[model samples]
Target: MDITFLGTGAGRPVSGRNVTSSALRLPAARGTFWLFDCGEGTQHQLMKTSHKLSRLERIFITHLHGDHTFGLPGLLSSRAFSGGTTPVTVYGPKGIKQLIEMSLSLTQTNLEYELHIEEIEEEGIIFEDEQFTVTAAELEHRVPCFGYRIVEKPVSGKLNAIKLQGLGVKPGPVYGRLKQGLDAELPDGRMVYANEVKGPSIPGRVITILGDTSPCENTVLLGVGADLLVHEATFAADLPDKAVEFGHSTTIHAAEAAVRAGAKKLVITHFSSRYRQEDLEQLADEARVLFPETLAATDLLTVPIPRIVEPRE
Candidate 1:
């Protein structure tokens, strides 16, 4: 999986950065990507990247703030215009459906695909499938907001081809059965067990993406043990008071959350407009004081989440 930051500025768009938007591109087998927080000019940002609206499978809105939602309507409409026919599911806080529907209605924009809007009624598991599970929790924002924890299901281990060959097991349909953790009988009546030839299963990655907010318990709860934690650092370390007043987080707060959550890496975005491009490294440096794996998100930056290789017995 890879996360691409489309916009990284907070509050409003600036010359160097746009507002808050990011895309999570899944593996090729999925053939789709999920979007997080569609800030203004998000569609334009998509145009600049390799991501396609037609392949956008899901959208998760953090809040109803303009900086997070203004581009939603336009992007939805453009998706249809660009020949998107697959269904799209949107998950967000209450009033998200109304906002999208009302905007599309007023603009008379017709969608070519089915749009499924799920307004979060509670904080828990909001989405689950065979491959992934998504949990939502409220955050301390000025308005109602949420953070999402996406956990990919564990992947099965690969079959040991060399072991099979060494055992004189010729490659055939029986190999498929063994790969599924089933016992397979060879033509000579020899039994082959999957566990005997397969390596240990790999643990799936955990990713947590948070909305704009002050550091709170839910932040750490949602980000616990995350392989990648995407948190907003809207202010410098010295602006703790300002951060608390505005219900936003500072560099220190983000790093602290990462440390408490035991996150493997922290990617900070949604920077205040006052910070110039050159100053972003300094802000990230502040967070790195506590969490050395901290990285400041830049527009169109892509970060890949690698799979963990388990040791064999």
Candidate 2:
């Protein structure tokens, strides 16, 4: 799996940073791309990248802020012209349906693919498929907002070819059968066990995305031990008063939450346009003091999921 940060600026677009948008790519799902947020200029951003618009199967909007969803109508319209035939599902707050309908109607634009929109106000599990399950939680923002937790069940462990070869097994359908945990029988009535060939299944990966929010109980709960925590750090701690007034977070607060929640890595984004490149890196450095694995996100940066391995018995 890989995560691509399309835009990370908060409120407004900066020269280097665009806005709050991210694309989650699941390698196990034929490179399925799930987008989060669609700030202004999102279609242009997609045009600049090699990402296929058609692979965008699901789009989850954090809130109704212009910085978060202004690019929806344009992206939706362009998807059809850009060779996107598969139906797309847009999940957001209640008024999203009305807004999308109004925008499409006012512009006299239509879509070729089935555009499915789901309105979410409450918290809990909101999405599921063979690849992943997404849980939504209400967040403390100025307006009705939500955060999403994406949990992915991984594939079984890699087949140990050397171990199989040592057991006099040739590479063929037996390897597939062993991976499927099926024991094979030989002509001599010998049972070739799957356990003798396949290793233990690896643990699933949990990725939590924190939308614009203040320090909240559920945020910490959902972020606990997350492989990656994408949180908003709109300001520094010195501006705590301003952060509270604006319903945003500081770098210190965002880092502390990740530290307290035991997240493997902390990715701080949704930065205010006031800071420069050096300043964003400084924020990441500040987070490193508490959590060594920290990243200051930029547009078009893709992060591959860290491989996990279990110790042999």
Candidate 3:
């Protein structure tokens, strides 16, 4: 699992950064990319990268802010022209359905695949599948914003080849069966055990994507133990008053939340247009003081979640 920042800038697009948008790519799971927050010119930002728009399985909006969601209509419509026949789902707060309908309705854009929209409120587990689960937590912002937590299903550990060989098992399809905890029926009618080869499965990665918001206790609760925390830091540590006034978070606030949540890594993003790339170091230093795993996010910066080896493959 990995997160790529498509647009890390706040309010407006900067030279080095775009706006507020991100894409989560799952390579091990056959290269699926879930887009979070379709900010203005997201397609244009994506064009700068090697990422394929057809890989977008779903899109989750943080709020209705233009910087957070102006690229929806174009991207969604262009997918059809690009031969994307797979279904896509969009999730957001109230008025989201209406917003999408209005955009498509006005443009009279016909989609090649099913387009589903869901408007959410309150905290709940919004999405789940065999591979991953996504939960949303209501965040305090100017609008009904939400933070998302993505937890991938546990992974299986490598099979003990030496152990299997010792048991007179040759490497073949049988190895897969053993690793899957299935008893292999030998040609001689004897059963080859799974414990004789497979060890254990590893835990999957956890990632938390914070929406625009002020520092709140729930942020820590929602972000706890996440392998990576992609959070908004609209201002530097010195501007706490302004952060609160705008219902946004400061760099120090993001770092403190990461520390409190015991997150493995903290990626500070959604920066205000007022600052320059040179000034990002000041904010990053403040976060590193609290959480050793700290980084100032930039456009297309991909944060990797280390692989782990679970019993349930």
Candidate 4:
């Protein structure tokens, strides 16, 4: 899995950054990408990247803020003409359904594919499939905002080819069955056990993405043990009062949250417009004092989440 930040500025667009938007590209097997917080100009932002509107399978809106949702109607409208024929689902807060419906209705825009909107009234497991599970929790924002925790399912270990070969089992269809944890008997009447030969299963990755918020318990809960924690650092450490008053987080708040959650890495975005491109490094430096793995996000920055492999028992 990989994350591509489409826009990284807060409140409004600047020359160095746009607004809030990010794309989570799943493996090719999934054949689609999920969007988080589609701020204004997000469609324009995607035009500059390899991610296409047609491959946008799901959208998870953090809140109803204009900077986080102004691009939804335009993007959804463009998808019809962009070769998007498959159904699309959107998950968000209570007002999300009304927002999309009214916007499209007023514009008289008709979509070619089915559109499903889910309004999240309660916080818990919002999405779950065979491959991934997504949990939502409330955050301390001006409006009702949410943070998401995505956990991928564990992948089975690979078959031990050397061990299988030693048992007089040549690579063939039998290898497929053994890989599925099934017992297979050789032509010579020798049975091979899948568990005895297979390596240890690799643990799935955990990713936490939060909406605009101040430092709160939900932030730590959603980010606990996350492989990648994407949180907003909208202000510098020196602007603690401003951050608290505006319901935003400072660099220190973001870094401390990552430390409390035991996150492996941190990517801070939603920067205030006051900071220029060069100033981001200093903002990141402040956070690095508490969490050295923190990185400041820029537009179109793609971060790859590498799989964790476990050693054989």
Top-lDDT structure, candidate number = 1
Report lDDT (Cα) of residue 245, candidate 3: 89
What are the TM-scores, per candidate, against the unseen true structure?
Answer: 0.97, 0.92, 0.92, 0.96
lDDT by residue for model 3 (1-313), tens = 6788999998989788899888888865477689999998899888877678887899999899889888999999998987788899999999888888999999999999999998886788999988889999988788889999988888666788777777778878887788787889877787888876666767878889989999987789889999899889999888999998889999889999998999988999999999898988888998788777899998888777777543354
lDDT of 2 by residue, 1-313 (tens): 7788999999999898899899888776376688899999888887776678987899999899999999999999999898899999999988999989999999999898999999996788898878678999888889988888888776677788898887777878877788888888755677788877778888788899878998787778878888999999999767877987888888888888898889888899998888897798888887788778999998888887775666889
lDDT tens digits, residue span 15-57, model 4? 9699999999887788789999999999999999889898998
Error of 4 at 225 (Å): 1.2
Model 3 lDDT, residue 31, Cα: 72
Worst 10 residues of 1 by lDDT: 304-313
lDDT of 1 by residue, 100-217 (tens): 9999999999898999999999999999999999999999999999999999998888999999999898777888898788989888888888999988888999999999989899
- RMSD, every candidate, angstroms: 1.2, 2.1, 2.6, 1.4
* Candidate 4: Cα lDDT at 220: 100
Worst ten-residue run, lDDT, model 3?
Answer: 304-313
**In model 4, where do residues sit more than 4 Å from their true spots?**
171-173, 185-190
Superposed on all Cα atoms, model 2 deviates from the true structure by an RMSD in Å of 2.1
